[model samples]
Target: MKKIETFCPVRDILSQFGDKWSVLVLILLEDRQVLRFSELAKAIPDVSQKMLTVTLRSLESYHLVARKVYPEVPPRVEYSLTELGQSLLRPMHSLIDWALDHKDECLK
Candidate 1:
């Protein structure tokens, strides 16, 4: 893998996790085996069908998420995290904890 420049590393990382919906989706699917599209949509209220489709596609392209399609009367699809994606759980949880701890000051 190519090493990103010091000036660009933060930007690159942010680009990967900057989307609010993507972060929430990742967190929701972190430990869970898999979730259907409808289930994900329900779990994450207020997300539009278009946005969820786009986000899932982006995550799948980045290898952060896996999409599985099953053949049936109506096609069934599910999404789950890949190994690299699962690795993000720890850091994400840490960030959540930090934000909770600093909520008071952060809100100022």
Candidate 2:
């Protein structure tokens, strides 16, 4: 297959997942498959409610995450990865592995 050249820099891609909260949300959803807003907040206590809301919205806008709202008495919302989002796990995990492997060098 031929590779298409583009003017876009890798930083554009990195900017999306490079944020502190986005990757954490992604990894959490990846492990749990799906989670409610409360569950995510509980799992990541350091993330403010506003930040989590913003992160989920951004991820949803990018088509990397799906949000489902259920009609109930108080209402319910859940978050999960889309097919496109699932594709990201491989590279994300690879980066995690690389960081773990190079932790000593990186810390120096």
Candidate 3:
């Protein structure tokens, strides 16, 4: 395949998890360890159900989130970060720290 045919890793990764909702979802999971769909929805009150679903699907597709389903009368589903996802938290924290430190300057 030509070089152009190869996907840009940086762009692809950002496209997958660049949005506010995606970052919020990942951060929530990082803090909570495990949460049900409803719990996640409740925690992020501004996020619509559809947006949450989409974000969760994207994270799961990236292997950053794991979904577990329990076969029960009503069924139970939970989400948590994988090892790879946990590893990403370190860099995310660094980015967050940078943003905080530059917030005033960037806003001006």
Best by TM-score: 3
Pairs with steric clashes in candidate 1: none
Q: Which stretches of candidate 2 lie over 4 Å from their true place?
A: 1-9
Clashes of 1: 0
| Cα lDDT of model 2 by residue, 1-108, tens digit | 434445255657678767989999999999999999999999999999999999999899889999999999799999999999999999999998999999999999
Global lDDT of model 1:
0.87
| lDDT tens per residue, model 1, 72-93 | 8699999999998888778888
lDDT-best of 2 and 3: 3
Off by over 4 Å in 3: 1-7
TM-score of 3: 0.90
Task: Give candidate 1 misplaced runs (Cα > 4 Å).
Answer: 1-5
**TM-score of every model versus the real structure:** 0.86, 0.88, 0.90
Every candidate's lDDT:
0.87, 0.91, 0.92
- The prediction achieving the highest lDDT against the true structure is 3
Error of 2 at 14 (Å): 2.2
